[model samples]
Target: MSVNSQITRTRIMECASKEFMEYGYQSANMRRIAQAANVTTGAMYNHFSNKAVLFDALVQAPAEEMLDRFRGIHAQFKADLPKLTFVHMKETAYLGTDWMLEYIYAHFEAFRLIFCRSEGTRWVSYLEELIAVEERAYCDAFGKRGRRVEDMFLHIIAASGFQYLVECVSHDLSYEKAVAVLDSAKRFSMAGWQELFKL
Candidate 1:
């Protein structure tokens, strides 16, 4: 870890993230990042081979951090199922999201980088391992309760109100306000699913 390398990498990413957020991916300029970072274009290239590679790193850094946290939960939950309910649909999980937003909400550059279609497949592939764990839960619960709809449980979890609840709460909405909605969101979905299999 060369100090020069560290400083250069940080500077480029800081500037580049702002560029992407302001102009979006297609319009982000390497020259702008170099200028903003106070580094020569050659210096920017020294750390990242290309814009695509830099974007990939930007997406992966937060992703890897989240994966590490999720993996930690997976390990703990494997040992104790209570932990799943503990984390599921809870604001406490956003400890990481809060930390991430510190860097990410700068312009949502990082968020857009990972969430836009360009990075979805990579994200799915990375989370497939975690998705597998939830899938197993679906299978187990379905088997125990005779529920047959296992195909999209993970998808529902991803699309459901939980995410909305979090985003809203992050915006300074009271937990009472958010949870008032989130509980309905959770119960309605949970009830529908439970009814689907009579859980």
Candidate 2:
């Protein structure tokens, strides 16, 4: 693409990110994004095929990368299960959570879209999918320990983590402050897990 074409595409994505963040996928309008970008509909289409495609362009790479990282971490955790003691488990959990937080920080907008602004998009189910993965891992490690209680714990802890992230973004918390908050939350979550499971 020519320099002008690349610039225009970037502009479209910038405006589209704002639009998606403000109105979400379902309510965001292509025309409004085009207007905001100072480009026509035809110009926008020259870069992205459609609204969903544009939205995907804004978030897909970071989202996929984050999920892939989680999958890798979970695979490692599963492999080490037999040898994991409480201290080892806590260390592993902190490492995994810290890695995830770094990814989120790197792609803050994409995650904001996925976690907070994706109500109408296919990505809306991302959180549920993550929780499902956690549920599966819990089941594998702990056996069938009352599905209702298991789900409740998983959902609450996951929601709390996500909410902390959302607050971090929405309020523009400094990196040090955000990490401090996240570390505290992680310790509290670990304590809850230990108490619940008598680990």
Candidate 3:
């Protein structure tokens, strides 16, 4: 793309992001996005094929980046589990959450769009996917002991963590406030996990 085309695409993306975040994927208006970007609808189509494509352009980068990070964190968590202590877990959780909060902050609009306004996108079920992965990993690691806890309980906790993140971003919490909230939630979750798994 030339300099002018690049600028136009960026403008279109920014405007489309706000549109998607405000009206959700299902309700977002393509013409409004074009209008906001100061481009013709026909011109916008030259960049993005359609509304879904535009939504993908708006969110795919940040969503994929977060997925990679979440996967890495889960892998690391499992790798370190054999010798995990409550103290170590707490420390790692704090640092991990702090890092995650900062990442989310950097992509706040993208996250808000996916987490709160992606009603018609593939990302709408993202939290469920994350929870299922975590729950399966826990069960694999702990065997019959982990199975003792109901699947619903496992799902609830996993879902809660994702929801907590959405809450932090949706409310626009500051870094310190977000970290503090994460720490408090981590402590509470740690206590529950310890009681459940005897970790």
In angstroms, give how far residue 50 of model 1 lies from its true place: 1.4
Q: Write the per-residue lDDT of candidate 2 for residues 1-199, one digit (tens) a residue.
A: 9999999999999999999988989899999999999999999998999888998998889888877778777888788887777788789878877887787888888888887788767888887766666665665556423334556776676666667777887676777888999899888988988887787
| Model 1: ten consecutive residues of lowest lDDT | 89-98
| Candidate with the greatest lDDT versus the true structure | 3
All models: lDDT? Answer: 0.58, 0.80, 0.81
Q: Once superposed on the true structure, which residue ranges of model 1 sit more than 4 Å away at CA?
A: 1-5, 71-112, 116-133, 150-184
Model 3 alpha-carbon drift over 4 Å, by segment: 144-147, 195-198
CA-only RMSD, every prediction? 5.7, 2.6, 2.1
- Please report how far candidate 3 places residue 196 from its true position, in Å: 4.6
After best superposition, candidate 1 residue 17: deviation in angstroms?
0.9
In candidate 1, the residue pairs with backbone N, CA or C atoms under 3 Å apart (3 or more residues apart, or in different chains) clash, namely none
Top candidate, metric TM-score: 3
Q: Which candidate do you rate higher for lDDT, 2 or 3? A: 3
Over the stretch 1-199, how does candidate 1's per-residue lDDT look in tens digits?
A: 7998898899888888777656666777799899999999998898888877877777777667665766565455445543344335234334433433344444344445554424323443543544565555445444443446647765566444335533643354554565455556655766665566444
Candidate 2: list runs displaced more than 4 Å.
Answer: 144-152
Full-model lDDT, candidate 3: 0.81
